[model samples]
Target: MEKLRIVFMGTPDFAVGILDTIYNSQFEIAAVITAPDKPAGRGQKVSVSAVKTYALEKNLPILQPTNLKNEEFLAELASYNANLQIVVAFRMLPEVVWKMPKLGTFNLHASLLPNYRGAAPINWAIINGETETGVTTFFIDDKIDTGAMILNKKIAIDSNENVGQLHDKLMHLGSETVIETLELIEKGNVTTTIQTENSELKTAYKLNKDNCKIDWTKSGIEIYNQIRGLCPYPAAWTYIKDGENEWNVKIYDSKYIEEAHTYSIGTIISGKKEMKIAVANGFIQIESLQFPGKNKMQIHELLNGTQISSEAFVK
Candidate 1:
């Protein structure tokens, strides 16, 4: 129960909240391990990870290793002499690193373990039309997302909740869980539960460009879920062809019309302030979308400037 020295590993904004919460806690943070700076944006300027920025501001030691198994990096990481290591939104760690900490490394995952176990869990849960999702903290093991569970906290997924909304919710929920986990570890009261392997478990594989493309042949509800699941990041995109003009349009927000429609799927029905695409069940009413080289905007705003005819078909 003595003051525990901890090391944190993460890279994205999702990890930032948890790191900030832990940094403000009573435990001593030995060092932070994050991804190396990479070039980004139009100028291709080097950009630091969110964790690194926050760690620098808090004056915490940082180590960004290009190779996790490198001897020099491993030696430096071992020098921290941390009792526990916490990971959130980070790459898979080698056994040498996760096994080094006395209390072992625990990862903050976006979904409840034993289900939706993979990258992009939040997106897959919604895409599969699940009404519930949760966050879990588990000990790091050799297999991805396959580890003994420490604790989990469930949260309801609204019928129409998008991935972006669910992501922020889980991020904050995970912060609280991480703090509770640290307390459990310090008190020596942690009991790990083996993750039950189910053959029917739905693995959340990382989304790709091809997978995010809207499939108009599906029902309106299915299309609606797909749009929301991929919203605000790697959005659901489709080709819009207007005679000689064919361009890609990414859908960010939409609604489903359950009423039956006779029109063939992918038919674009446009109006002054509203646009809908025909599907097997009915239509997917476009609410917010982005054109190539343009910022996301409402259907009306897009219609006001673009000459998208009702006759134009969506592919």
Candidate 2:
């Protein structure tokens, strides 16, 4: 087999592990393609992407093209002379770039193909109360996530697992799968499978406030899934309001109990150390949360710092 000269494309922390795997593999990494550095925070300090940071640490050649279709950028990317490209948590690629490599480009997605095929797969899978999810590697094509699949590996989702935990699991899984896919390509024994379509397919669409907001009117189990699905990032939120004031609260860790209850949904049943929100058919015991204009804290900490009136309720 000829040597595999690979160019890796990714940006976020999720992609860092896969990049490291390829770097330490038998294949040669010709260059890295990551998002450009941007200014952030109150002080406006420039922040580099996690992938770029790792690439700098390893002294790998890095490319941050502002415009993927720019003539000069495309010319420089072609100069790398890589045979294969691996994309992780990166932006959508133009056909001109994805088709640059001789062996073609493949992407590692966070969820099983044809399902959860969008930006926030990890979050959506758990939010939708799925019992199983996995990672997939497929050859890049024109449409999003519609390419011929190369390999897939499945894993069960724990009952109480949050998005953060699931993301770590898939990241590790993707690293392994990418390595195996490279080997399959090298041996020239790989068989690509076209994805099947159905009317009931689930899509992991982009998240927004409309989807992240907690609806206490729903069953506790449904709310519970929604809470954990979005936990630790773009958290599930509700408004806690008393007779005097209302505050936006982001709920992180929580547990729910299903039982008969007369209390109206969205009621805030709380004591000094404990806090629970009444949902349809049950209550969600909040373990950790964040208040407007404050850092995250345990339910007890928030209770002690800011008292909740007896009439407090959620909106």
Give each prediction's root-mean-square deviation over alpha carbons.
1.0, 0.9
lDDT of 1 by residue, 70-111 (tens): 999999999999989999999999999899988899999999
Q: Pick the candidate with the highest TM-score.
A: 2
Model 2 clashes, total count: 0
Error of 1 at 104 (Å): 0.7
Worst 10 residues of 1 by lDDT: 214-223
Which lDDT value does model 2 have at 32?
Answer: 96
Per-candidate TM equals: 0.98, 0.98
lDDT of each: 0.92, 0.93
RMSD in angstroms between candidate 2 and the native structure over all alpha carbons: 0.9
